[model samples]
Target: MCKITEELQQIAAELLKEGKVDLVLGYTKGEQEEQSVPCIVTQPEDASKLIFDEYSEKALSKYLLEESFQDKKVAIVLKGCDQRAFKLMQDESRLGREDVYLIGVECPGMKWGEDLSPFCLHCDYRTPAKEDVDSLLTGADIPEAMQGEPLDHEDSFTDINRLEKMSKEERFEFWKRQLNRCKRCYTCRNACPVCTCRVCVFDRENPDYIDRAKDQMAQHQFYHVIRAFHVSDRCVSCGECARVCPEGIPLHLLNQKLLRELDKFYGEYQAGIDEVPTPLSHANADEPDFFGKEGKA
Candidate 1:
């Protein structure tokens, strides 16, 4: 067992025994040999069940927002991206800061060796800052063994680049090939922590934007674009969307493209930095226009 896993178990044990939290949200081995699943433990004795490893890819913060967790004093283990989402939720009034305790872990970047999730490759926020968390289970410094050299943000967009480089006819052919594999499973949307609207606009009953034709292209376009737009400001780049995709679509690329755009245009603002406001959520009139509309005038 990893030392970090032991430490996490010990901390969870202490929290549960001391009545510091009503529940502890963490990960344990799933039914499958290679997968890890989120588990909510309420007993101190069950703290031993918690595990942390490369397979622990799901963002635990999503469970915090569910109705089951409401008003309960919860302790959640957060990787850097998960912490960012929690911060964004707090900022947006989706969750109260005082209601939950955060155990910040210094993520040494997740595994990218075998069938890597797209978000993991582009993840910039691997280490959680002590100032941003309730309590630091791990120190501020990343372990030398765990740090992978920073990845070029642009490298995650191979499909996007391929699309851009193709002739218009070829580009249309490429999307036809990819969209043909889409099963309309909605697993990608469901796994996303940021897709928390009570009634998702993609639902057929949505009067605001309903597609009477029910064309597959419209469904695919609407689902992907609307989901991306909703999470543009608050996405933590946790890779959950891609992880849950049965078709193995690189959905994180779309989210990361928006994140890169936000960072480029709005400066380096991460979703969970408690001090900085989300870029789209707050705007400044003095900021330079990246869209070039100002220069034309």
Candidate 2:
């Protein structure tokens, strides 16, 4: 891993030295010894600060949409899932492929102490699969000898299936108990890469659409339910919202349930795999009705 880090730094330095990119987005040593934070290096000499390890958990691609990086050629260090954001942004017309350079890294998974990250456990893509990558940094060949154990969707969906077995009233009660803990911080909304609207519905100044009172159950349910519907088709299951929640809410469960229903009704669909439009992106008379128009409220 140390060797890989050295190679990554060297590449970033070279790109900056050659003027290949105006900015190089990567990770630098965080305040914690074992953690790393997202960094934007503008000078070639500063590229030596870049590092990749078990602590590189944050998705850096989302920063490309920021005003500071806009309209400038940038190079980014990306893992398989992180690279998906580039594809999504390009398809959305918010970014252009030609304006950015990709430094693909083979992810060996990330960890928080002895436990592996939920997103990394469920992921199988070890290397960035994007064809436009300017460079690739390969990890060690030994699978088990590497970092965290890679788990399949079956293992990852255990919580989702448990919720499915409950009766309607029981399910409502379950969510009520969980969401009752919400502080209305909106950390989940801000952390989500797909929640890229210029102005979010929840952040609107008008209180007429939905009440912002944190103590109200109606407000909590409204915030979560509306958010789940908004990202149903676009969610890549990055799990950032759940990770960043201070209240320890399993927010990913909501998105996972929506994904399962979409799969059952319209066949399996994985977002960010290609430029193909999501089901929500189109209107069709032949659409599958998972729930009737008069679904019980």
Candidate 3:
């Protein structure tokens, strides 16, 4: 096992042995050597199965919302991005802070295939905030150079900027090709930590908000668009949406575009970083109205 993995296992074993947490939520080896999947350890001996590495990319916080997990006193692993996600969940009142223990990781940035994740390239935080977690681990398992340092993050919007340079029709065609491949699998929404709707609009059959007919590309477009807007303000840019998409859709682009527009119109805001009262949750009369209710359209 990697050095940090051993440390994590030790920590988890201690927690489980002491009866501190009912279970420890972490990652363990998957079928692939480079793959890590979420694991739950209720017994101290099982802690040795835990591992930490670049493959520890999944947001474990989402599991806290499960009906089975809601009543348990749990401990969970969180990278910087996922720490933000757990914070957001707490702010939304969907989780009780007292019931969960946060084990923050000094992330070395996760691997997307061989290369580092694109979102990780511009990540501002490689470890969870010191105050935000109960136990914070250093990234000693990674290279000496990659141990939890804040990145410059100066040119973070390069992808969205490239899309902005396209002509209106070209941009339309760009997204058209991307969304066209969507299988309506809802994997992106499922992976998202902030897309926490008790009953997702896509899953509502009573309203039939979106019909999942494979031939209906129009509905596909609608589903993607509406879901993008739905999480625009609350998105933590964890990149889970794009990372988990089976169709390889760059769904984070839609989120980034809307975030930029929100910044321009309503001042800059980082959803989980800042306090509640999200950008769209409130409005001022002075703010520009794109809908043009004053008849400017």
* Predicted structure 1, TM vs. truth: 0.85
Better of 2 and 3 by TM-score: 3
What clash count goes with each model?
Answer: 0, 0, 0
Question: Residue 206 of candidate 3: its Cα lDDT?
Answer: 83
TM-score of each: 0.85, 0.91, 0.93
lDDT of 2 at 47: 85
The best candidate by TM-score is 3
lDDT tens readout by residue for model 1, 114-193: 65545655677776778777777654334344457656766866767776788999966766665556676778877776
lDDT to native, each model:
0.75, 0.81, 0.85
What's the lDDT for candidate 1? Answer: 0.75
Candidate 2 local lDDT, 48-150, one digit each (tens):
8999887787888888889988879999988877777667777888888898899988877777457767777677665777474788887633336344556
Which scores better on TM-score, 1 or 2? Answer: 2
Candidate 2 residues lying further than 4 Å off, grouped into runs, are 140-150, 289-297
Give candidate 1 misplaced runs (Cα > 4 Å): 112-118, 139-148, 208-215, 274-276, 283-297
